[model samples]
Target: MANKIILTGGGSAGHVTVNIALLPELTKRGWNMVYIGSEDGIERELMTPYTNVPYYAIKTGKLRRYFDWKNFKDPFKVITGAYQAYDIIRKEKPQVVFSKGGFVSVPVVIGAWLNRTPIIIHESDVTPGLANRIAIPFATKVCTTFEETSAHVPSQKVEYIGAVIREELLQGSAIKGRNTLFFTRSKPTLLVMGGSLGSKRLNEVIRDSLPLLLQEFHIIHICGKGQVDETLTHQAYRQFEYVTDELPDFLATADLIISRAGSNAIFEFLTLQKPMILIPLPTSSSRGDQIVNAASFQKNGYAEVIPDEQVTKDRLVQTVHQVYEQRSIYMGNMQKVKKRDPLLAIIQLIEKTALSDRSRNKKEK
Candidate 1:
């Protein structure tokens, strides 16, 4: 029988991209892959094209740091999710399991542990997420995007393999991207993204500053699903609800990025050597991972960050212009500080861990 592996992660595209990046390589290595995620989560939609990989959905509860009514109801959901995951793992009998830390992954990691399956979890931020924090004790290895993350995780199990950039993303063409949207070809393009779910505040500020921005830069706004404004359709500004195949092209056309400081997305920008003005989620609303990620990039001269509270039309426009003016500096810094892509190293680790697990299992048998 062929070697099998179960992949788990959901809630955000970030939680799944590493696994996605590894898929082609995994297939090349002759491993059959299965995915376990929430029934209606973004992972299901994102993974739809890989029809060969069967997807299993388990009931998942949100793991929130703040108080909410769902907190009481969600633990039971997590327990059920674990039971479902256990059943799946038992039947699948995979050599190893990989989890990209999200609430949905916690149960899968626990289930894999119960089944004595080796688990590898990837953490994309300098600070470990809540789900990964809970899942770490059960993981055989934890792959991290940032070297600084070692301080937050157990040094023994953590490895500093950098962010996985998808192969397709690198194949984007600037000419193709320019042709996709008819615009002032000579003007520089600014790409704006508010994450998978979209950011209301980020959207509002950008829309408010559009007039001033459009004069200097063509705007391509990925306004998240259902966040598009039907009322406004300016020639200088184009808004997309969401994009898949055309994403690389859109990214290719961008001279500057305006984005939330999510580690996975920002790292992609860094790898592309794109100058950016990052707006991080406020600590009051999030665990503030973005704040740390953004600060690190800014301190290294790769990007400039503007706090949410400080965002206004004048500041936003001025900041964008400032970042654009310093584009060469950011690109140079990005090139200077660039780390080797960790995809190959991570695949080797996965194979090694799986081989060892299989050997141990055979001995026990």
Candidate 2:
């Protein structure tokens, strides 16, 4: 029988992208993959393209740090989701459960534990997110993109696997990207990504500084869904709510990137050798994981950091020019770093853990 695995993660695109990266490889290896996620999340939409993978949606509650009226109600939702996840795990009988940390993953991890399935969790940020922290006790192995994250996780469970970038991202065509966007090769291209949902501050600043920016470069702005401004269409500026299949091409075309410091996105930028300016989410908004991620990248000389609160029209414009001027230095620093096959490492770990569990079960029998 072929090995079967359950993949779970959601809430944001960051939580889901790693699992998406894993799908092709898992499928190629003949693993039967099932995805468990929230009833109506970006995960479901992202997984919709994979007709072969069975997607299971469960009810999940937001794991918030701050108190809200819903706080009292959400635990019950989490309990219900746990029950649903348990039922699905029992029915699917996957040998292993692989989770990318998000609130939706907690119940699934609990369910996998209840089912005596080996659970492997992937943490993308320099620090584990709340969901990963909650799930860590149940995980057989916790894979980390940043080596520094090992200090936060249980020492025995942590595996420093680095980033698992999507394979297609490395295959982007700059010529194809320019032709598709109708951008001229005469000017450098600037790609602004605020992540999957988009960044309101990034959108506002980029738009505000467009006149000055467009003079030097062609701009591709991936403003979040419904955030597109129809009024400000410039010849050198193109706006997209999001891109899926064409993302690789866009990444290929970008000479410089201005983005929020999501671990997955920034790591993808690093893998592609793109010089970037990172504006992390402020502590008031998030648990400040992005701040840590940005700092790490900056320390490695892979990126320039801009605190979210300090983002302004003049600062953004000036920073863009400075980063572009010193782009080669950043690229040189990135190229100096040795690359590892993290996807393969994680996959092998999953297989080894599952096999070990099976062997132990047989021995007990």
Candidate 3:
């Protein structure tokens, strides 16, 4: 019988992308896989077309960070979702569960714990989310994208693996050093990204600051779907709503990047070893995690953080010029850092854990 493995997580690309990078390797190793995600989240939409692996979606709603009277029902919803997840796990009897935490994954984590299943969870930010924080005690192993994340959780439960960004990024990092996407002059290329939807604030700042950058550098802007039609008619900006296949090509070619400090994007920038100017979303971010992630990246010397309230055309221009002027120094700083081979590490972890579980079952038989 083939070894079966169950993977669960979603709500955003930050959580779901971890699974995207790992799934292909699991399939290559001949493991039967099933993906568990929230019915209404982005995961089911993103993963369904790519694989035949069965997907089970449970009804889930996001829990607000701030206290509201409506918060009273959260535990009840979690309990219901947990029972649903428990039923799914019992039917599949997979060897192990790998969860990337979000509110949607809470029930699944609880179910895995209740069922005596071995569980591994990945935390992508310097600060762990409430779901991951709660699930840490039940996890067989906890992997973190930042060293700081462990400070908030028990040290013994964490492994600092760096963020597991998508495999396409690793492919983007292979060669071309600082010149892949839009190389005009020997001057650095600047790649702009604002989450999956693009950032109106960052776009506005960049739009205002474009003339100054255009004189010295090439710009590849992922305006995201929302701003694709926005009037960014600047001669210097090469904008796209989405470049699904060419994103890696753009990153590989960039010398510098202007982007939001999303966990997945920041890790990709570091892995590529490029200098970046980060504009983190407001403290009121939907997930309330981007602020911490931006601050953490600044502390680590990987990037410069520009808070949303402080981001302006002049500041954006000045910071871009400052980083460019000191390119050699910043690039050297990035080179001093070590990066994980996300694909190899994730693939090994899943294959080894699944095989081990299979071996134990065989012994029992």
- Give stretches of model 1 more than 4 Å off: none
Q: Estimate each model's TM-score.
A: 0.98, 0.99, 0.88
The lDDT per prediction is 0.92, 0.94, 0.79
TM-score of 2: 0.99
In model 3, state the lDDT of residue 263.
90
Best-to-worst ranking by lDDT:
2, 1, 3
RMSD of each: 1.0, 0.7, 3.0
User: In candidate 3, what are the lDDT values of residues 7-110, reduced to their tens digit?
Assistant: 88887777788888887777887878888888788788778776668999886656778888768976787788899999999999988899988887888988
Pairs that collide, model 2: none
Candidate 2: list runs displaced more than 4 Å: none
How many angstroms is residue 72 displaced in model 2 relative to the true structure, after the best TM-score fit?
0.2
Candidate 1 lDDT, 1-365, residue by residue in tens: 77899999999988888889989999998999999999999999889999989999999999998889999999999999999999999999999999998999988998999999999999999899999999999989999998899998887899898988988888998889888888657799999999988888999999999889988999999988789999878887899887778988888899999999999899889888899999999998899999999999899998999999999999999999999998999999999975686899888988999889878988999
Largest lDDT belongs to which candidate? 2
